[model samples]
Target: MSHAPTGARRREIWLLVATFLVAVAGLIYELIAATLSSYLLGDSVRQFSLVIGVFLSAMGVGAYLSRFVGEALRGFIWAQILLGILGGFLAPVVFYAYAWTGAVELPLFGLLIAVGILSGMEIPLIARVLKEIGAPEFRFENVLSVDYVGALAASVAFPLLIVPQLGLMSASLVFGALNLAVAGLSLWLFRSDATRSQWGVWALALLLTGAGLVQSERLVTVAEAALYEDDIILSETTPYQQITVTRFRDRVRLFLDHSIQFDSFDEYRYHEMLVHPAMSHASRRADVLILGGGDGMAAREVLRWADVAQVTLVDLDPRVTGLFQSHDDLAALNDNALRDPRVRVLNQDAWQFVEHANTQFDVVIVDLPDPKNLALSKLYSRAFYSLLMERLSPRGVMVTQAGSPFYARQAFWSVVQTVAAARNPVQVGAGPWTLPYHTYVPSFGDWGFVMAAPFAPKTGDLAVPPGLQYLTPAIWQQSHVFGADTGPIEADVNRLQSHALVGYYLDGWAKWFE
Candidate 1:
């Protein structure tokens, strides 16, 4: 017959399990806090660095303070209960504070310190408990080894499974439950060792964690409500980015990963300039390709020409394309361009789409976001432009949204230089004529665009369509001129390996913050 394990063996098993559980739970909380901070504030590097620094310092403080506690087992149990309660509710509280008071740093850092201190004490107490119970193999080294393994698992699970499946708000509560589970199991196993106060704290922690689990979804909605200015119509977290649509009166806005993509009120100025400049100069507008214009605003501008036979739009996010396709207000804003018979939407990465494209386009509009990160920097690289050049018709035109020349002059010039470096197609030997232009949009001031064509383009050749709300022939030509402040500066070509453009973009925009 199988017999119950001896107390020593049981203690060894529970302590090891506790070490692993606490390690995973602790790192998950740290990641969630850092991610939320990055989303709310700009610059991922800065936010993550600060969160990790504060967490590790607090952990050191906790470890040092653990020497004062008399009972190791009691200390471990209380630490687990406190960690579970505070860490589980952290995300929701941070969000609520931001929404109600526009204060996030204090509450965020306060919770991180609390969770870190409690987590730091967990492994030390577990090691002490096992040694006291006469476990021969219970050493600090063994405890630390198991803790590191748990950390590796948590790092993998965070982005791949936790954030995508459970989201930041709910994931915290789930991990918090794991923390409480460790404490509850320890309480059951060591019932003879527990004091009255430890039992009461454990009960209260269970009640609080259970409530968080049940109300997780509602709590997430309430927290997210504060992040947007208008009423959120829909929000989805995809592997690539966070997609949010908000509506205020007749105006609608789309935000990708918490950065504003567009606001309906003044988007026409941006879209009109992006499209008409290239469309008007191109020899034929019949076949058009649009990369990264998921909202369909650019397509709407291209579709104005009755002669344009087909418009193929490639955007990375299906969530973005699907939202515009289904929403009545969003559809109407784009003149139902996504649903147009002549327009075909492909939900795929723009880089992959361009590299393998079998068809040639008379006009290609590159309306991608600014090169703020590595993934986006590749799109602005010379390699991407070279591949794009091969797909253009003999006399075709291409235009890219180069960002605010006034704010990011070096980045804007880098794009202009990259397009020119792509060189003119052999079929049309006259030039790889590059035209840099900027227009004032109230939402985004002094935005820039670079238009490149196989043959030299003339302002006189532009056949601008009638009824455009923003773009006039006079203003179209005038956009080529720039004020002294927004003028071009020399910049290195953005190669995939170097990724120098992201640095330039960051440096250029950093001044605004200062």
Candidate 2:
């Protein structure tokens, strides 16, 4: 039989609840700091690693400092109030710092340490509070076990619920409010032990966090204005990525995860360079397949060909495909290519689509972003190339947008080498199995492309489609001749297991930024 609840037992239960809520709040702050840093700066691996390292070390500092507190209950309550204020305002402060000043790493690591130290104080103080209320019934082990469970729960909810629903700024404020509530509950439970000073701090924390929750959207807008040069017309955070479109007069720019996808002014040159070479080289223009041109610019170029019958475009993000399909301003840029009856859009991962596609295509265009991270690096691997080669018809030709050869020479060469290695055998009327070509775009300088076919066409065999803004027949032939700085040299093939392109890409680009 269960006994009726006593005041002591109920106070202990409330203490345990406070422990869980504090743990969740602490972890959410850490994640928000790490994610925001990664978004603003490239190289997610470096940002997360450094942020976690600084955070954990500062936590150790907080733990050591906790030994000095004489009044355990008062110390714990005050720590909660301080942590609530710090973690609540962290995202907005960091974003404002980034916008006004170029120094992000300094403030980013500083806040990580501050929050980590305060959060570190929390678990130890809560453990002490539990002991003060009830001696042997609530052991140190029980408090620690509850703390760990809360952390695990927070980690799961961060990506699945918190980030998807509240986003980075608002999520921080909500969790901050929760932290302040824990402090309030602790003061109420231990009213006999609390002083007026502690109550005052809790009230101040409550007011600040309330203001943060209300002003989060305004803060996001101001930060965005500083980050982007053009006026931002549309911005949305999808489950997959951050999609932002900015407009500067007549020119429109699309940014995905803060990386530039295309600028409308010069996109014709990039798209024409991507689509025309393969379409002209292919024996048949019918049944064309595009791997990652979700923007519909590549499809727009492909449709210009008179002989083309059906165009299948596969892209991972439905948000991107849907926007390009519907939005009038964006649709006008792609010439309403996605809505065209001849084109079929499949919102799926390119890697999975290639693996599952049984049909063959006469022309294939790969217009994916640069492989700066692991997820994108996989798209450039030899395994992906092998899968892509499987879908090419006997007389088919393929083209892929290799990044700037001048800036990322080794990475550019790696793409060219990987495509050739994937198609190593089966020589069919060859002058060269793979041809590397590049054209200058005003937006992105010295961009490269690799045109591969089962049978190599002659030097002047490829023809540019009519009604093109860039790439005439003569200009197409001239694009193959790259200057000394931009021309390729020897590089290792990018394999799935090794992921050589990611390293090469980082090494090549990091120097430019420095």
Query: Which of the numbered candidates is closest to the native, going by highest lDDT?
Result: 1
The C-alpha local distance difference test score for the whole of candidate 1 amounts to: 0.86
Look at candidate 2 and tell me the lDDT of residue 315: 92
- RMSD value for candidate 1: 3.5
lDDT of 2 at 379: 87
**After superposition, candidate 1 runs with Cα above 4 Å error:** 3-11, 45-70, 97-114, 135-149, 209-225, 356-359, 423-431, 458-461, 490-492, 507-510
For residue 395, model 1's alpha carbon misses the true position, in angstroms, by 2.1
- lDDT by residue (tens digit), candidate 2, 1-514: 7797777777788888888888888888888888887787766776788788888899999998888888778888888888788888888788788888867787778778888988888778878877776745667888888888999999999988988788787888898889889889888978988889889988988988898788888878888899899999988776667888999999899998778899998999999989988888888989999988889999999999989999999998898999999998899999999999999999898999998998989898999988887778888887887677778887788889999898899999999999887843345333227899998998888889998877766555657767888888777878889888877788999987888888889888887964
All models: lDDT? 0.86, 0.85
Candidate 1 residue-wise lDDT, 1-514, digit = tens: 8688887788788889888889999999999899878776645666889999999999998898888878999899889888888998888888789778877799999999999888878777787788788897557898999999999999999988998898877888888888889888898899898888878887888888788779887776776676777988887777667788888998888888777888898999999999998988887889999999999999999999988999999998887888788888788989999999999999999999999999999999999987887778899988998788888997889999999998888989998888888845654454477899999998788899998887776557457788888888788878989889888788998998888888889898887853
Q: Model 2: runs farther than 4 Å from truth?
A: 1-4, 423-432
In Å, residue 506's CA in model 2 sits off its true spot by 2.6
TM-score of each: 0.85, 0.92
